[model samples]
Target chain A: MQKLTFPRMGESWRTFKMLLEDLGNEVVVPPRPSKRTLDLGVRYSPEFACFPLKILTGTYLEAIEMGADTIVTSGGIGPCRAGEYAMLHHKILADLGHNIKMVVFEPPRFYPFNFIKNVYILNRARHSIRGIIALIKKAWRKLQALDNAEKLSHVIRPRELITGTTTRVYRKGLEWIDQAYTNEQIIDAETAALEALRNVPQNPEAEVLRVGIVGEIYVLLEPASNLEIEETLGNLGVEVERSMFLTGWTRDNTWTETTEGMTVKAAAEPYLPELVGGHGRDSIGNTILCAKRGFDGMIQLAPFTCIPEIVARTILPKVSRDYDIPVLTFFLDEQTGKAGMTTRLEAFVDLMRRKKHFRQGNGLLTG
Target chain B: MKAYLGIDVGSVSINIVVLNEAGEVITGLYLRTKGRPIEVIQEGLKQTAESIPPDVKIAGVGSTGSGRYLAGIMVGADVIKNEITAHAVAASMVIPDVQTVFEIGGQDSKIIIMRHGIVTDFAMNTVCAAGTGSFLDQQASRLNIPISQFGELALKSTSQVRIAGRCTVFAESDMIHKQQMGHQIPDIINGLCEALVRNYLNNVGKGKEILPPIAFQGGVAANVGIKAAFEKALGFPIIIPKYFNVMGAIGAAQIACEEVSRKGETSFKGFQITNLPYRTGSFECDGCSNVCEVVEIFEGEKVIGRWGSRCSKWDITGENK
Candidate 1:
């Protein structure tokens, strides 16, 4: 059997890796995509392709170089260009003369059945349905643990009295979770990490600006692609809450009957009225929810030339006007510079601070 | 006498202004940067020093613009700010009730919305140079007229000839076609102004409530043609300040004054910065796979300023500092 590999989008990689391993398949987890990976993708991709597709292509190229003969990646089924990514990537790799097998887990079409079949074929010899189900359950639990650790770090990092203490502990927590081999070990690591985080000194009364980040999932989870925006905001004393999480998204979209995605769709109805494609509806709904929850401001980070995001960008102004919460949208690509982004962020922070002061002086609620 | 100094080092021009405690501009200098930002800044400082009174003490110094960090390090600035904040401050000082600010500089343009002297919203042009000063400069040279006279020529037009203003390349090609169609030069120029103003309104001013009492500043405000076009399009009179071209410098100086009043001390390095032997260079740091290009500014062979690195390993001064 050929080795399988996938791009590292979030902590879901660990869960995916465990599931494939339990099925008795040799899986090669490619290293985290860096600038070198991006350059390789850019050199071979169509000039105007969305940034995420380029990163995925780069991941596959690297994995193939590391003896990964079969590539596994998520495929989109929608009006957006995401639906075309898998076929395009296949053509790009074949054109580059690297013949390989690919199994794209496209949702709502070849979902679950194809997934199960692929796993069964990979297992061949030790195919126990009960063990596979248990393995999947354990992976799900680990994903939840990983998500909780990340949420705690996001909450504690901004208000830490000693600069970088929360960040250090958060890194250790992630490392602990990543190294744990069993469900019990994962639970223990999270508890110890959370306890260490609690020990980090934080000013309870510090007035921290709360920012909600809503955008494409690839840019949201991958710090390298988005220029470590969450870290940068934390350093600037802003408590950032991400609008998307892998475990929640997977549960909502598959297997479970979850109303979270439906609720967001309803909230976005007045503005968007239709799910244009990708996360366009989610971006609008999340920004509205964040504002309703009293967040100071919202940031939308999308790849340059992205279609669905461009739709959201066009409609976000209406959201900003109605909610009275400033929304800053950044179109990121390889051409984006840190200096310009930093300057815009600083100015946006200044604007939010002054708005808060103005409301306070007028005897109104700062939120 | 105590004064505050503001240095604005932009891609197209460099400006320095000194303001007294009363917020009056004591002396100002504007020079073309022409790619040599460091040399131009030094010349601007030396020239500004010669114009100001010898007894005037530099109480505070602030730097702004695209090249602000480098300028701040060279001048020991008390406050380093972005162009939006600096421009908003400058506009508010000029017209206390300014609701909208239309700033069109050489390479970039921005629209800042304000309410009661505080900035409420702002947007800047990205990846497009259609409505900036450089676009107008190119059109002026193409039409074989001095940029200073372009505005006057537009005012003399009796009819309108539309030129595509969505992109620079399209605008130039459209201008040539209009010329071939026998449109009068003044009419074509006036149409160009109207097109650029339309582009700015459609791109930068989209979805913003631009109220009355608007102040138009930046180097591009020197052109009366664009100002008139804006006035006609928005159905409001555009107020051009006396120091419209040097407002960024003025705003930086105002911020420095505010900083000094709050802190009761100054970080101004003084006029001697002009004589300091400084050198700037950049090299790619191969620490990780990122390979970030880190720029270093040296003052007499000591690394005083470093930037452009994604990480702070070479910044010397910690990232938070």
Candidate 2:
């Protein structure tokens, strides 16, 4: 059996490993990306590469050390430099003298022969094509369930009476989803997770500010990369509306069109009509939608030196001005300090809270 | 007399302020931090305590600035706030209808937009802090002039020269080149001030509507050349508050006042803390490769509080969570 592994991509690692395991491969899962992983990557990768690139490189190295014989991950294409990540990672690994196999998964519709070879030949899928299709469908459902649980946590965390309750419950919810094998079990797990989050002792009357989170998909989805921003904001009494979910991202990236694709594009049409590269257009579109929906504020996150998000960030001030919604664009990198991020987040939330108070009261808050 | 005390321990300076029940500044002291925040804060408190009336009771205490947490625990602050909110509160209190606030401190600069006494939007210098007060301070000393006289020298300039303020390295090199070409020192300083102002507005003040009646505070506001450059750029004369150097402390004091009035009790540890022996120490936590540098506050061998951990595993508060 080919020892297969994939780089950590947010919380999807658990579900992804399960999918690979059932597909007739011994999955070698690396520990979730942490400081050690980041340091390992930074030591080898180019100094000015995108944050995700360095992180992914480190993850692959750790997986190799853990006995992963094959690395599998999707490829990207566009103005963003992510399109070259797999090639560069492979080169870097080879230069380090590790002769492991690297499989770059392209969209099946566009690269059918390569897809079949990866699935049926190298991966050795034990089931019929139809059965494999059903398995993928099941995995997709599980992922959707996990994403749902995560979204629910964003809503429940702010109102939770006991600090850290939502975080514990969310972890339990992920564990349940991971251990689930059947479709009904996945559904039950999601229901149970949401139910537990709802059952968390909470002050429902807690006034929460709605803030939309927009930016590069990697930073948005990866908890470590963004430093558990969602949790931090939630603990500070802000409800977050994440711009991208894996389901929507998977759908849009596949040959099939997504329901959210046209809407996001149309929303971004007035501000940024063309795709600058990598989620740049979508970020602008989501900010506009948030403004129209009357969100109190939105914070844009991007990797340091991220071109696409930088392009989006430069145009965001106009959007913030025209819509009367506050926008805070922040970049993430190795040097980003927890203290600085906390101060900014606290100050932004305070600004929003004071703004709301002022709008609700007529100069009565001067006290 | 009931009073609220605010302590601002920043990267370069420590400011302590006391406000009366009417929110008026009773005593304010600004002292150089010199990389020792703990000692400076205690000394500042001692100085303020001595300057104020003996009967002025400190009803509440608030801490702010970068070292807010450290200062908060040491002084038993009722409210620990970020610098932005503190500055906004102080600005609006001083200039009732203040529309804009420009705060240039030691390591960072920020622009706050306000409407109807509320902060609408704000931006801080990120990634690159090229145009902050520390940079100006360095340039002034490099020119063999005291920082206090750097601005006055600039105001005496009779010519204009362009200095690259995009990066500090480039700005310093350009200043040297201008000096080699025999450009007047006053003109060069004036050019540097204008360049710094342009960079600040372009970077931190980008896309924000900088309306008039702006209030310029923070330590950097002491530079008249920077003030002139700001006026030239925005075409509006900015008002420097009475307690410009200690505005952050004033804001923290006001916020504390409001908090104590609402809660009907104070958490003030009082002027006695200045007489106590307090120390801060940090150690790395080997929790899952994060290696978080957890800082702990101690009072005479007793651990008082711990912070700076990502997972918050080391967030110990002595007897309480």
Candidate 3:
């Protein structure tokens, strides 16, 4: 039996596991990144690697301990160091004397003999190509449903009458998604989750500050990495619209690359003409779009020492000045204190609120 | 007389202030925390009670700084705010048209940019402490010079030598190297001030427009050498507020006044809290991987508030449940 496992990412890990299990493979799902995972990862990995790399290093190690022989991960084709993550993980694991197989699914543009070999290793079930396509399509549907459910919860969270109601419903929704064994189960889970989210009582009379979050993908998606910032903002009565949802990010990569997510590229092109690697371009572009859409402010969350985000951070001040919006850039690391994060976020929210009120007052005076 | 009490409990010092209805300072006191906040808070409250007349009534209370939550719950604060907002509020009162506020305390540094009485943007130093009050304090103590007189010695320097202020380790080594180079003490201290100012501008004050009518406050603002270095860097005179060191408490007092008048009631726990034995304890909740440390506050055998847990299972204060 070919036992398979993958790094734990956002909620997409559930769908990824379901896809592998449907392919007649035993899948080991690593537990969520905890204090132990972080400590172990930091102990082994270079101290300078970005937080995502460290977290992934920890996740893969946990999965290895859970009895996995093969690791399947994606490859990137950008100036960003994310492209080298899989190779780095392979080397780091090997240096520690664990000789397990690593199946790297590179982007389609670089498809060659290695890609074919990796594919052959993955086809342990020996299913037909059409059967594989059908299974992949099934997994993609679940991905969209989960992202939509999560997106809906964001709108309801800031306005929810009772604190933590949206979070509870969303978590339960993910559990239902996890329990899915077929297409019907996925639909039922998504519908029930969406219904529960809408059913959350909200204060319609309350006004909320609209803030846009743009940053690196991992920190944006993972709650543990960013310290649950999306939920934190929502509870503080701010409507958060994030730029990088896995639905769009995954849709634009690999063999199924499409023009759907390229709009962010165009949006960011005026400020950052070239891809400096990572999500740097996407971050700038999203901030411009958010400003044009009349968001009260913008926040960029980057892992500490992330080269691309640091490059984007320099250009962001100009974007803020031109767009007439306030931008707050935060670097995430293990040393980041919870109290300090809350203090900065609270102060930023207060700034946004005051500026918004001043703008409205000016509008009323003139209009 | 009616008074609004404001307490700022920080890492190094605790400041207590009483402001009357007109926002005039009736009394202000400063005490060292010495790593024992509970004892320091009770001592400060007791001293304030003793200093003021018996007829004077504390109509409202507020708290700020890193220990704001603990201080707030202990005294039943009407307003609890972060150090940034509190400092900004206090500075605006001193310099009404203040465009920029530079605050460097013991453990952290921050820059607030304000336009037309609204804070437009702000930035705080990262996890690095190479450019804060504590940085100077450590160097002063190491050099056998009192912190109060360190700045005066720097002002008497004739020549300057640069020190790397990006990290404390590098800066300390660089200072020693300059010392071995046979440079005078005053010149090296002056160079250290400039290095700290450079680091502060490069990090905390990065991309911030430091327009004039700038107010520099906090514990570090007491250093005339740093003040001069700041002026040299920006080419503008900096305004040090009258209550530069205790501005957080002053701002808290001001905010307390506003909050109390608006609510028409005060939650000030009274000076009698000094007599009550308040106990605080913390435990590690191994519920999951997060390993959140939960803190509980007790008032004479009765649990008052509990927080610091991610799951909110043990959180009694709705702060982070």
Which residue runs does candidate 2 get wrong by more than 4 Å? A362-367, B316-321
> TM-score of the second chain in each model?
0.97, 0.97, 0.97
lDDT of 1 by residue, A1-367 (tens): 7798887875567767777776777889876777889988888888899888888888889989988988777777677888778788889999999897878776633387867766666664475788776777887887887788878888888788876778788778878877777889978988988888888899898778899999888888887788878877776778899988887777665666368787888889999988788888889999999899998899999998888999999999999889989999888887777887888887787788778878778421111
Q: Is the docking of candidate 1 incorrect, acceptable, medium or high quality?
A: acceptable
True contacts kept of each: 0.43, 0.57, 0.51
- Candidate 1: give the clashing pairs: none
- The candidate maximizing lDDT is 2
Residue B282 in candidate 2, Cα distance off native in Å: 2.6
TM per candidate comes to 0.94, 0.96, 0.96
Quote the B-chain TM-score, candidate 3.
0.97
Q: Each model's C-alpha lDDT?
A: 0.85, 0.88, 0.86
Indicate whether candidate 1 or candidate 3 has the larger lDDT.
3
- Candidate 2 matches the true fold with a TM-score of 0.96
lDDT of 2 by residue, B66-117 (tens): 9998898888888888899999999999898999999999999999999888
lDDT of 2 by residue, A292-340 (tens): 9989999999999999999999899898888888999889988888788
Q: Please, what are the lDDT tens digits per residue for candidate 3 over residues A1-367?
A: 8678887767888888888877778999877888788987888789999998898888888888988878998888888888898889999999987777788887655676766677567776877878887888889989988899889888989899888888988889888877876789889988998998899999998678899999999999888888888887898888888887888887676556556457778888888989898899889988998999999999999999999999999999999989999999989977777788888988888788778777767411000
Taking all chains together, the TM-score of candidate 3 against the true structure is 0.96
In candidate 2, residue B305 scores what lDDT? 82
